[model samples]
Target chain A: METLKINYKNLYFPPGGILMWIIIFLELITFGMALVVFAMYGSEEPEIFHQSRLQLNSTFGAINTVFLLTSGFFMANAVVEFKAKNVKKSSFYFKLTMLGGLLFLILKSVEYYHKIDSGITLETNTFFAFYWLLTGFHLIHVIMGLVILIWTNNGMMKKNSDTEVVDVEACAAFWHMCDLIWLLLFPVLYLIF
Target chain B: MKKTLLFNYGLLILLTISTAVISNFVAIKSLAIGLIMGLSALKFMLVSFEFMELKKANLFWKVSLIFVLFLIVLSVVFISN
Candidate 1:
């Protein structure tokens, strides 16, 4: 009888941890489903969708994209530095990541204020309904990511803290998930419509 | 690793600018939308593979991520058309 061997190196082990990846997948699916519904309605009311989309500031969306991507880059570096046992450098990168999250929230809030001032509300139309729901949900995720990053950073800052590498990696994974969600949202909301 | 990450970062920025230009300045609507979505997928891949370290992850995760992206993009494009 021949013995079968499993390739351990190629086997799937979720980055960060199993639970974190599960959460990531669930979030992605939720957003993806909402986007699909948005698209269906968009096709049904092309003119409305197009006009509503044009009212949005793509420039602001682009700027937010840059901010989130740069933040994600810094967060990734934080994980790398942590793995290399450079706790201070990792914490610095985490701070940068949080800054990026703050900037995104500020810009998004400004955009929302403009919409409200212009008399655009969730009840304004189908497009605006999605506009508020999708982006607002994502904003919540960003806030959560920032909180997690801060907690991870604080843990790292403590003297003789027993913060494990997995904890930091999990935070990084969550931050990157936020970036990924934004990547999907930006194009669907700001560009493609 | 650092050099590779830096290179990816530059690529992401370049892609972002290109997406903006294509979406805002391009006269052909279909072409612009197509390019924008394509660029978005590329950006997503870069972030997942590099920043998220999905490149080193299991085949199941990589495939699942790509599959979800495909579904979303396809649905949007299909509806728009």
Candidate 2:
């Protein structure tokens, strides 16, 4: 009975703690609903969606997917290293993770530049509107995630720092959420018309 | 554990590449989209379960997350139709 109670508590808390998990779920639901609506809009005008999707540069999208996923993997390793009390290795992995994120942002900026160059702003059309809005919101999340990762890494490296395991886990959880959101966005906005 | 994580990473990259190639090259539009979405779903499950450590969570969370996303992906399939 004692073990059961402890197990229940642990489960309730999760890796990044219960509050972070709640936020993750809320974010996921919000993105999921937006995607559903995006698909509904696509169904209404397949041609516009198809044409807009063609202009999207799927190669860029695919490369970004790789970037985010690779970062996510590095993040998982960082968490593991942290758990093992290997702060140096953990910090190294965190740096690699940030590099992945930086690569993603640079490439995304180029993609956005191309869109702007071609005069494809949010007001261009329905497809472009969703493209800019959904991905724009996601970009904000990625930026926020990078800030958290840097903070977490710096704190860990500081002597006598008070950074907790749960803090790192929370940062990682948030980072992976970006990956999850992009997973949906990539296919819906880029592949499926 | 690290080995397992590395394996999952490799698999995800391969799946991502294959899904992109298949969706782009396949002749049938609906078939291509369907296959791509299905593969996307698989990739989603892989990242959530392995990388996010959802596999270590309780049954409730593990099941809820998977089922919710699966349903959302299904809705996406129907929406694209």
Candidate 3:
């Protein structure tokens, strides 16, 4: 009897799925362009950007970095636990992952509130405009990511769990995209000026 | 796989902390900026390869995504300088 072998080399199914990877690439490109433009503008008005960056709380940015990275770690472990069919372990890890995300969001919201209280807005300056738009957009992605994680976790809790590996992979991929985007944004927006 | 995941997470956390601290305490402004960007790229690659499982992905996707990062980083660094 002859057996069939699926070659992933020529196939488009990367880690999560082709469709998901496509979205990742597109989103990266969009943000990548914006970041480059931001850098260019910073060069033009280095003082304004530097002063604005100093106003940004680097401590908040650093703590958020730890939160997101920790979350991503928990998320990867959840996927591992799920793949082993250890639903209980997976559920625990999933909760931890969500907690990390929740903490990040709460912190970010507090930072945003402080910014608003101080009258920083898109119209404040070029750097502030990019800051509000880029970080705000990334925050929205994190919210969507949390929604997806909750949905998948709920699926896993059902009597007959319907969440597939691909589904979880897709979810993790989206969540990590949030992390990845934040990595780029953190250094440039908060650190580099 | 478990060991690999743990190791990746460890390196990621280490890198993140170092980047933040170095940028905070480093005396040279230009040096700090360069180091931060470089470390950020390391974080990007770690998440993509380990967490996102791009190491298991096809070469095309892996290479393309990396190239994209390189371009973005290069442009930002050049203009910032």
Global Cα RMSD, each model: 4.6, 3.1, 2.9
Model 2 TM: 0.95
Listed in order, each prediction's TM-score against the native is 0.95, 0.95, 0.95
Q: Mind giving the per-residue lDDT tens digits that candidate 3 earns over A1-193?
A: 1123324365567767789889999999999999999999999999999999999999999999999999999899988887777777988888998999999999999999999999999999999999999999999999999999999899888986777777778889999999999999999999887
For model 2, the superposed segments whose C-alpha errors exceed 4 Å read: A1-9
Q: Looking at model 3 chain B, which ten-residue stretch has the lowest summed lDDT?
A: B24-33
**Per-residue lDDT of model 1, residues A1-193, tens digit only:** 1123323235445667778888998999999999889989998998999999999999999999999999999998998888788888988999999999999999999999999999999999999999999999999999999999889899888987788777887899998999999998999998887
Ranking by TM-score: 2, 3, 1
Q: In candidate 1, list every pair of residues with a backbone clash.
A: A12-B58
Residue pairs with colliding backbones in model 3 are none
Interface RMSD of each: 1.8, 1.8, 1.5
Each model's lDDT: 0.88, 0.88, 0.89
Candidate 1: tens digits of C-alpha lDDT, residues B1-81: 388888999999999999988987888877887788889989999999888888887888889889988888877777776
Model 3 chain A lowest lDDT segment of ten: A1-10
lDDT of 2 at B39: 84
lDDT of 2 by residue, A14-129 (tens): 76667877888898899899899889989999898889999999999999999999999999999888877888999999999999999999999999999999999999999999
- Interface DockQ of each model: 0.70, 0.64, 0.75
